[model samples]
Structures are given as C-alpha cells and as structure tokens.
Target: MNFSYSFPALRGIQAGREFYTVMCPLRLIPKIFLFDEEEIPAEHRAQRVMNRSRIPDITNYILENPKDYIFSSLTASVDGEMIFQEHSEELKDIGYLTISLDSKFLINDGQHRRAAIEEALKVFPELGEETISVVFFHDLGLVRSQQMFSDLNRHAVNTTSSIGILYDHRDQLSLITKALISDIPLLNRYTDREKVNLSKNSPKLFALNHIFNTNCRLLGKRKGEIISEQEKEFANQFWVLLCNTITEWQEVLNKKTSPRDLRVNSIVAHGVFLEAIGIIGYYLYFYHPDEWEKYVKKLKHIDWQRDNKEDWQGRAYSHTGRINKNNETVQLTANLIKKKIGLPLTEHEQKIEDKLKEASPLGT
Candidate 1:
C-alpha cells in the first residue's frame, strides 16, 4: 500500500491498548480527519454532527488574537489500522505511524477546533504551517466511539469565571478588575477571585465578580461591560472614600475586626451591601458631585452592625429568610440607606421603602 501520508509519531501503550500521537499540520487536517454528518442518522456513526455556529466565534477569536489562543490535542478514532512502522530491529517496535487517507477517520473530540483551524487557515494562510497534536486509537466502532465522546466530556470541568478572569488578559473588564485588585489593598488582601460566594469563615470580604460588577454598576454600565478612564477614577475614588468612611471596613484594614466575623455578623462584607452602596453612589455622583465626598461620609452612619437583624431580615432577607440578592431586596436596601442619611428617594425607592415599613420588622 502507498503509505504517502505517514507521520513521525510516538508509539505508546495504555491499558494494553496501542495509540499513536502525531502532530498534524493545519492544512492536512481537513483532508485526513473525516467528520461524517450523514452517518449520524444511521446510529452507526461515531461522531455527532458539528454545530456550525460554534466554529465562527472560535475561528474569530483565533484570528483576532492569533498570539494567545490555545487548542488542545484532538482525540480521533481511525477507521482502519494505525500501523506503526518499526524503526530498527535493534530498537523496540516504536516508530513512525503511517495513517492512510483511504479510510474514514472519526474525531471523538475537538471537532470544533479542527473546523476552526480550517477556517483560520483561509483567513491567515500562514496559519497553515501551525500544527495540532492528534491522538489516534483503533476504530472503536459507533457504540464505543460515542462512549468515548461521553467519557471525555464527563471528566472536563469548565473553568470558573473568577479563575477565567484570573487568567484572562483580553477582556477590558478583567483588566480593570485585575488593576483594582492590585491597587486596592483591601481587595488585594480579602478578595477571592476563584469563588463567587465567600464562605462565612472566608477571610475574603468580596468575591471578584462582586467587586467587578459593582464597579460596573457604579459607572452605570451593564454587566460584563467596559468603563472609561474617568468612570474608573470615579469608582476608585468612591471605593477609597467608602472604605475610609465605613468603620467596619477600616477595622478590617486595621486588624481590629476579623473579616470572618464581619461577614458572619453583618452585611457590610457582602455583595448586596456593595451593590446598594453603588446604587446610592450613583445618585451622589450624578446629582451631588460637588457634595459627593460630603455625602460619601454618610456611609459611617449606616447601621451595618448585623445584630440589627430587626432592620436587615425584613428589608433584605425577609422573603427567603436568607440574604436575598434580587433587585427588590437590593433596592429596598438602597432605599433604607438613602433614607437613613436623609437623601431624597425616588418614587420607586419610596414605594419599596413603604412596603418594607409595612412588613413587621425582623425580630432581634
């Protein structure tokens, strides 16, 4: 047989199963790896039909930022024998693997990456030289192929958002969040980027998303949104003053109050409180810019002490009997804080406050 498509490969054995690893160039991928959508209806097909929509974003991400994106090796099952031609008689049987194009090759995983590499090659022809590792195994018919697909995905745990932001440098929000963590001592010391919810005993005062999202709100931006330099400076100023004004925050800064106790006993260390403060700060920023610092001093007056459950449970946690972070509770909190400091409430705020006032205040 004409072995014109042989690749220098490493031969390996796992669980008594023989597999071959080869680095396949981008240009040869489409020709060698066959994804049969038609085989899907036959139930004899090993791979599922490709989702056309997912390929474009992946291709675009690669093309837009060619320097940073990574595509892991593809796991494929060959329709015929993967014959590893021996190197020499004196050496072991390990040698180059000759895979033929004459037989079908089904991709058990990374079908999307294969499609994206093909698309990226069209846009950037130089990308054709780029190579992706391919792991080839014996033709495990349709049933085993489908099982392989399931087994591969079952073990894959998606990276969490905090971890994603921790590693990602491309998104503007992530960049700003990273900067804030670096510059703000409180955040740098007490933030948990890997978790969205800080545990009761966690030393963290805020989740990374909470800090990032609250900054978005303070700038009057949407979730996962970007902000300008002016808005960023304003948010920074707000944080500095808010921390300075809030005694608990400063206490944490001074080693006087443990973040764990503040988190367990009060709402000061929670996202809802930060969000509510962001909402209040929005009003001060817009209507009272000249008086912003003066109004910010009002944070000290907030009865953040959690033993005041009489006020907290009814206004913030009355619905579910726990910290409810929905818009309604957050608004009620914003209203309560605004009123405590004698800021005029909007009609919506007044209405929410009236409802909270009507509910029996939570018992201490």
Candidate 2:
C-alpha cells in the first residue's frame, strides 16, 4: 500500500515513553484515519464500535460556532514505524514525520472526535486549514495495542465541573458564572473554586458549577443562552440584593457564622436552595418586577436551620434522605417562596406543583 503522508512533528517523552505530536489539517484527518471496527478481527481491534449518534452534535458544534471549540489530542497507533527526517540545524527541535501504513491505522483515543471531524467537513469543508493535535504511537500488534487502549482510558479522569467552568471560554454561561463570582464578593470569598462538592471542613460556601447553574435559572436562561446587557445588570443587582436579604448569607458574610457552620446547619448554604431562589427570582423579575425587592425580604423568614428537617423534608428532600435538585424541587421551592410572599404561581408552575403535591423528587 502506498500510504505515505508527511507532517512536521514535535518529539516528546513521558516516563521514557516516546511520542510524536503533529498538527494535521482537518481535511486530511479523515483520509488518514481507518476505524478498526470495519476491517480488523474482533480480537485485534483495540477500539470500541463507533457510536455514529454522537458525531452529529459535535459536527454541528464545529459548524455552528466555527471557532472557539476544543478537541483534545487524538491518540492513534501507527501501522508501521514512522521516520523522522531532520530538516535544518536551526530547527533541531522539530522534524518531519513520515509514515506509510502497511495496515489500517488504529485509534486508541478520540475516535468520536475523528468521526465528528469527518462529518463536519461535509458542511464546513472550508475549514480545511483548521488543525487538531495528534500523538502517534508505534504499532504493537493486537495484544499490545489493546493494552494501550485500556491504559489510555484507565488513567483518564473526567475534568471536574468547576475546573471546566474556570477553563471554558466558549460557553456563555461559563463567562457569566465567572463574572458573578468576580462581581459578587460573597460568592467569590466563600466558593470552592476547584470542586463541585464541599467537604465537611471546607470553608468554601458553594461549588462554581452550582452558582453558574443557579444564575442561569435566575436569568430565565436555558443553558447556552446569551443574556442582554439589561439581563446582565438585572443579574448583578438581583444577586447582590439576594445576599443582602438572605439572613444566613448575611450572617456568614458578617462572621457571625462560619462557612462550615452555615454549610452544616442550613439548607440555604446548599446549591439546591440557591437554584430554588433562582427560580423565584426569575418569576419575580420577569412578572412582578415592581415587587422583587419586597419579595427578597420574604426570603429572610425561611427556617434554614439544618435541624429544621421538618421544614425541608417533604418539600426539598426525599424520604430516603437526599436533596432533590430537579425541576420538581425547584418548582416546590418556588411555590414555598411564592406562598411566603403572597404571590400566585404561574399556570405552568401551578401544574408542576399540583403533580408533585405529595412528595419530593429524588435521584442525582
């Protein structure tokens, strides 16, 4: 097989394992990759069967946004040893990698991304120059190649939600979440910036993920919705007023209560309640604009004490002892606040409330 292809590559080593990094143009990727599912013996194929369903969303993501997206480095097994040719003394650090595949190339990672890239090309073929990083491993036949696949995934841990929020610039909600944490001192001062869950002794008040989701709800936003400047300002003013009005939030900020104590003692410190407040805030701001501040006062009356299990049990927590964080709980919490403030539920909310009248929703 005349399988020659060449590209400039950077040489790197990890724990004495050698790998070559190459920037392959988008149009060339599909041509170079050969999914193992099609030709190889079942025992020899290191990759899972390609899930065609996942490709379209990723393909649309590339086509729709066109820019500001990420695809992690694709890991593939070369069909044969690739040769590195030194080009110049001045560029000793980089060299051209040339490969001739004697057999079908195998992907140990990023198979879905590879499939999506190919699909995306059908519509956005002009993105031919766009590049994705790839790391090549020398072929090790069937058994060793399978082992490599196992090893690659075994060490891969999903990125934490907070870290994703902190690093993502593409998602509009991530940007708003960052702004909220920066603009609201209370959230910034007490938030666990790296994790989604707070440990018992952690001084941080909430997860960055939690706040992002809560604020999105408050803005009446579905995920990925872009907010107008008016909505942004509304968010800024509403959250500041919320912190000022929620008694436990004020006590935590004032040092009258420690973050750990607040976390342990009150439902208010949980992200679930924050999201519930977001639902209420959206209703008040969207429908009762004139009475939002007045409604904020009603939040202070909630008996947030953790010992007040009677207060949240059937309303926010399930019988098996779990905080219900779904839409049902959100409506329930909104209804609770609506009752306290003497406001009526919207027709949609009243319906949800009626169905959930007897129990709290559960399951993570």
* RMSD over all Cα atoms, model 2: 4.0
Candidate 2, residues 1-364: lDDT per residue as tens digits? Answer: 2567788898778667667899999898898888775566677678878888998888878887887677889998886757877768887648988887554577889999998998888888888899999998887688878888889889889999899889888777788888888888898898877899888788888899889889878887865667888888878888888878888887888899888888777788877788888888887888888778888887787787756765576566766656677777766776776777788888987777677653444421
Which portions of model 1 miss their true places by more than 4 Å? 2-4, 30-57, 87-95, 220-227, 279-291, 305-315, 318-320, 326-364
Score every model by TM-score. 0.78, 0.84
lDDT of each: 0.80, 0.80
Error of 2 at 46 (Å): 1.6
Q: How many residue pairs clash in each candidate?
A: 0, 2
Off by over 4 Å in 2: 1-3, 9-20, 38-44, 51-57, 60-70, 80-96, 320-322, 357-364
Model 2 TM-score, all chains together: 0.84
TM-score of 1: 0.78
Error of 1 at 328 (Å): 5.7
Span of ten consecutive residues with least summed lDDT in model 2? 355-364
